[model samples]
Target: MRIFPARLPDCLILQPQRYQDNRGFFQETFRAADYAKAGISEPLVQDNWSRSVKGVLRGMHFQRLAPQGKMVSVLRGEIYDVAVDIRPGSASFGQWQGLVLSEHNGHQLWLPPGFAHGFLVLSDVADVIYKTSAYYQADDEGSFCCFSAALNIDWPVTDVIRSAKDAGAPDFSTVFP
Candidate 1:
C-alpha cells in the first residue's frame, strides 16, 4: 500500500498495490499493521456505505461530541471527495482539501477526527464506502452548508442532489467557530 500525505496532518490518501492476471485483480483494502505503520492510530469501529448518482452531494457534515475519523473510498465509479479541517485549535482550521477517487484508482482517503467530510458523485453512479472510528449520535450531528462561502468548497457539479435536511443545514458562520 502506498500512503500519501494530504495537506492536513493525520489525513492521508492510501493507494493499494494491485496484482492483476488474466483472471482478474487482487488487492487488500486495509491492514491494521500497515495503518499503524502509517501512524493512523485510530481504531475503526463502524462501516458505512452510500450510493449516489451523478451530481449528488452528501455532506460537509461532522459531529461535535464524537467526530468520526473516516477512511473513505469509491467502490464503484468515481467521486470528488472532500474534507475540511475543523479542529478549533489546529493550524489547518477552516482549510479544506479534495481528491478524485475512483474504483480504478484503488485509493482511499483517511480523514482523522475533528474534520468534516463530504463527496460529490463524478460518474453516472457511484458507491462510496467508509469505515468510521466512532458510532453516530443524532444529537452530535451537525453540518455546514455544502457551498458555504466561508469555506468556499468548489463542488464540481453545479446542480447537486441533496436531502432537504442537508439543503437546510446551517451555514458555517452560524454553527462553527
Candidate 2:
C-alpha cells in the first residue's frame, strides 16, 4: 500500500495494492504493522457505515471529548469527501481539503483526530464505511455548517440536501471564534 499525504499533511490518502486476475481482484485494506510503519499507530476501536443518495451532504462534524481518527472508504458509488483542520494550535487550523473517493479508485482517506469530516454523494447512491480510533459520544459531538462562509468550502454541487441537524449547525466563525 502507498500512502500519500493530503494538502494538510496529517490527513492521508492510502492506495492499496490490488492483485487482479481473470476472476476479479483482491486488496489488503489494512495491516497493523504496515500501518504502524506509516505512522498511523492508532488502534481502530469502532467501525461505522452510511449510505447516501445524490445531492446528499453530511458533516463538517467532529467530536470534542474523544476525537476520532478515521480511515474512510467508499464501498459503492462515489463521493467528494472533505476534511477540515480544527486543531486549536495547528498551523493549518481552519483550513480544509477535498478529494474524490470511489469504489473504482480503491483509495481510502485518513483524517486524524482534531479534524472535521464530511462528504457529498456524487453517484446515485454511495455506501461509506469508516474505521474510527474512538467510539461515538453523542454529548461530545460538534459540527459546523457545511456552507459556512468563513470556511468557504468549494462544494461541487449547489443543490445540497442535508439533515436538519447539519443545516442548523453553527458557522465556522461561530464555532471557532
- State how far residue 51 of model 2 sits from its true place (Å): 0.9
Model 2 Cα displacement at 117 (Å)?
Answer: 0.3
TM-score of each: 0.97, 0.97
Each prediction's Cα lDDT score? 0.90, 0.93
Whole-structure CA lDDT of model 1: 0.90
Please provide, for model 2 over 1-177, each residue's C-alpha lDDT reduced to its tens digit, 9 standing for 90 to 100: 898989996888999898999998888877878778778978999989999999999998999989999999999999999999999999999999999999999899999999999999999999999999999999999999999999899999969899999999999999999
lDDT of 1 at 87: 91
lDDT, candidate 1, 5-33, per-residue tens: 99888799999889999998998987989
In candidate 2, the residue pairs with backbone N, CA or C atoms under 3 Å apart (3 or more residues apart, or in different chains) clash, namely none
CA error at residue 32 for candidate 1, angstroms = 0.8
Off by over 4 Å in 2: none
Q: State residue 176's C-alpha deviation in candidate 2, in Å.
A: 0.7
- The C-alpha local distance difference test score for the whole of candidate 2 amounts to 0.93
**Using alpha carbons, what is the TM-score of model 1?**
0.97
Query: Alpha carbon lDDT of residue 58, candidate 2?
Result: 98
